[model samples]
Target: MHTVVCIKQVPDSAQIRVHPVTNTIMRQGVPAIVNPYDLYALEEALRLKDRYGGRITVLCMGPPQAEAALRKALSFGADDAILLTDRAFAGADTLATSYALAAAIARIREDMPVDLVFAGKQTIDGDTAQVGPGIATRLGLQLLTYVSAVGEVDPENRRIIVQRRAEGGVQVLETALPCLITVLEGLNEMRFATMADMFRAARHPLTVWDREAAGIEDITKIGLKGSPTVVSKVFAPRPRTTRAELIEAQSGQPNDLADTLLAKLFTKHPQLGRQIVRRSS
Candidate 1:
């Protein structure tokens, strides 16, 4: 199938901290893990590989440290790993990131033609859900996001079918080859890595490419300059000071409990009580 799965190394959310004064992410002491959503994407790619007997390439764009994420993918049985790292790629927003990734994928195409590109619906840190679509737009690939299930892949005919999650229901979509998909979470369970796979991942020669190697000719299209979005400020949400108001039923009866809660709610918000009554009518 010649699938490429895009992944990222993100600070573990549970261990992430915000600077007290600056209110920016405190990444110094936080441990980095592969984005959980991307794991699902990788698992989907692996499933496709198992079915079709094709190569799966794990791709990542981050600092040198992001090779850890690529290694993790290799342990999961990916055929190859590529890390695109450069100082020029620093402070890149989704736009710049997609551009760099599309460029790298183009470089990969020079050797082997890619049939499908996979990515998470969104990164845990960014959560913009834009990069996949951006990459598809830049590469002129068919865009499919929030895919809940993959139906059929006909490489001979160059067509694929997928179940996409929409606002009200699922939409079955059939698209041409060279498509980019952003897979939704909870589609399938991830397989565990075997001992041999672990060892192979440890000894795997990761392909590391800098900006020039990745075929980024325009300096202005990468790094901070390429990113148009800017964060004016970051702040922690204010903690609530008020305590929960407990509704105690004197009788220990379900009806009594409901009555007590309703009384308290009505007392607190008379307008809400009137609205509820009007709706019932």
Candidate 2:
């Protein structure tokens, strides 16, 4: 089986700072790391590689700086890494992102046929949870989202089974290979890199593709123009006007606090108070 794990380099959420005027993230000083959620997907792909004895290829779509993310995946023991980057690919939403990735996958198939594709459930920056599904849809691959575990893989039959997370509970579903899966968080821990792996990754020659190299003929379809969604405006969330009121009383008695809160609530909104009381009762 040949497995492909898609990864991304994202700004550390804690360190993300937006430019006041430009409305763009100030990534210059911010620390960059592999998308945390993608780690789980990588580990899962690695596990499958370990068990199935196949090559694990890690792929990413981002700026040139994103080569770091692919190298990190290499350090984690992924067999090969590819970086899909072009100025035209900038500011692409999930739709356009999936277009580029799917095209890249089509190119990858020309060399070695891929059996499976893996993606993180969602990107922290985008939070759309759409790319994986979009890729699956474009490639006509079976789509599996929020997969908690891989139950089995029948290579000869080109089939696989997985445990999927649903609203109520887990759903065990079986699908065929040449499928795409978006993995849930905390499903698997990343393996510590061995010295040999680190050396191999550090020296590994990466395949960097610009628009032309990525076989992107339609310029409009590859980047901002091709994207359907538009971010008309992005601004910091306004601070809430009202702040929490602290209740201070004799010895901070709980019963007194509760009663006082009820009284205040009822005075402010009698209907709301009645509804709450009725529901509690």
Candidate 3:
């Protein structure tokens, strides 16, 4: 079984800087880290590989620097890593991102058929959570999102049982192999790398693919041209106009302040004061 996990490199939220002219995120010089949500997905995939005995592959789509995220996953025990990087892939939204990853999965299938595809619940910068479903839909694979646990896997029967989180409660679902799952967080813990894993990742030759190398035939469908939605504008939030009124007591008496506040509150909203008094009573 070959488990493929989709991960992303994101600008650290604490250091997000917006472009003054375009309002787009100024990712340059921003400390990039693996999407925190993706760590849960990667950890879940690693758990499955540990139980079922197979190789795990980490896949990411971003600039050349995104190789760091892939290398981080490798350090945590992923068997292989692939970075799909290209100028044509810039400014891609969720739809285009799904298309590009789907193409890469197809390319991987040629070598070793992927038994399972995993992705985080969503990206921090782009919390669409649509790409996983889009890939599953395009590839005709079973789609499972918000998975909390893998209850069982019947390799002999080629079927797996999983627990999925829903609005009101959890849903127990059964699906076959070659399924795509967007895992929920808190399901498993990421393991620490041994010295050997760290050394191997430091020297790991990541497979970098350009548009052509990734078998992208339709340039329009992989980048800005293929994205349906556009960010028309981004602006800073406006500050609130109103300020809290301060209650003053001439003699610094707490009871006097409370009485003045009560009078002021009743003057502004008599009904609210009535309700408060009733609740206090």
Candidate 4:
């Protein structure tokens, strides 16, 4: 079985700051790391590779610096890494990103057939969660989102089963090979990189593909021209000013404390008490 995992290098959200005047993200000094959610997908793919004894390729689309993200995946035992970077892919929204990724994957398929593709549920910077589904749609692959666990894989039969997370419970789904899965976090723990693997990753010759190399025929379908979504504004939320109120009772007993709390709540908001009474009646 051959698997391809997609990952993105994102600015650390913890250290991200908003520009005061521009009301945009200040990424100049922010540290970049692999998207945390994508790590779960990568680990899952690595686990599959370990069990099935197949090659795993890590794919990423970003600037040249994003090669670091692919190398990180390599350190985790991926067999190969591919970086899709070009000026034409700049300022791409989810649609354009999916288009470019789908094209690149098709190019990869020409060389070696890909049986599975994995991605994170969403990116931290862009929580839209649309790119994976978009890629699946474009590639005509079975789309599986919010996958909690992979249950079984029958390579001979070209069938696979997975546990998908739903609104109230989990759904067990069976699909054919060549499916795309957007995995939820906590699917599996990432393995620690061995010193040998780390050295190998540092020295690995990464496959870098520009637009033409990635088999992008239409220039208009990538980058800013293909992106239709517009960000109206970007700003930080205002800090809340309300403070918590403490209720005290002389008795300091649980029952006394409950009564005191209810009395204070009723006194402070008479409408709440009336609503409770009305609902009970």
Better of 3 and 4 by lDDT: 4
Q: How would you encode candidate 2's per-residue C-alpha lDDT over 1-281 as one tens digit per residue?
A: 88889998988888887888777778887888898889999999989888889898898998898999998999998888999988899878888899999999888888999999999999887788999999999999999999998888999999899999999999999998899999999898888998988888989999987778777798888688989989888787888989998766686899988888878899888999899999999
TM-score of 4: 0.89
Question: What TM-score does model 2 achieve against the real structure?
Answer: 0.91
Task: Write out the backbone clash pairs for model 2.
Answer: none
Q: Backbone clashes in each candidate structure, one number apiece?
A: 0, 0, 0, 0
Task: List residue ranges in candidate 2 displaced over 4 A.
Answer: 18-24, 243-259
lDDT of 3 by residue, 55-114 (tens): 998999999989999999999999999999999999999899899999999998888989
Model 4 residue 169 CA deviation in Å: 0.7
Q: After superposition, how far is residue 221 of candidate 3 from its true place, in Å?
A: 0.8
Structural similarity to truth (TM-score) of each candidate: 0.91, 0.91, 0.90, 0.89
Compared with the true structure, the alpha-carbon lDDT of candidate 1 equals 0.94
The residue ranges of model 3 lying beyond 4 angstroms of the native Cα positions read 17-29, 251-259, 271-281
Worst lDDT window (10 residues) for model 2? 243-252
* Candidate 4 residue-wise lDDT, 79-182, digit = tens: 88999999989999999999999999999899899999999999998998899999999999999999999989999999999999999999999999999999
Q: Candidate 1 residues 1-281, lDDT tens each?
A: 79999999998888987888888787888899999999999999999999998899999999998999999999999999999999999999999999999999999988899999999999988899999999999999999999999999999999999999999999999999999999999999999999998999999999999999998999898888899998787678988989988778888899999998998889889999899999999
**Candidate 1's error at 107, in angstroms?**
0.5
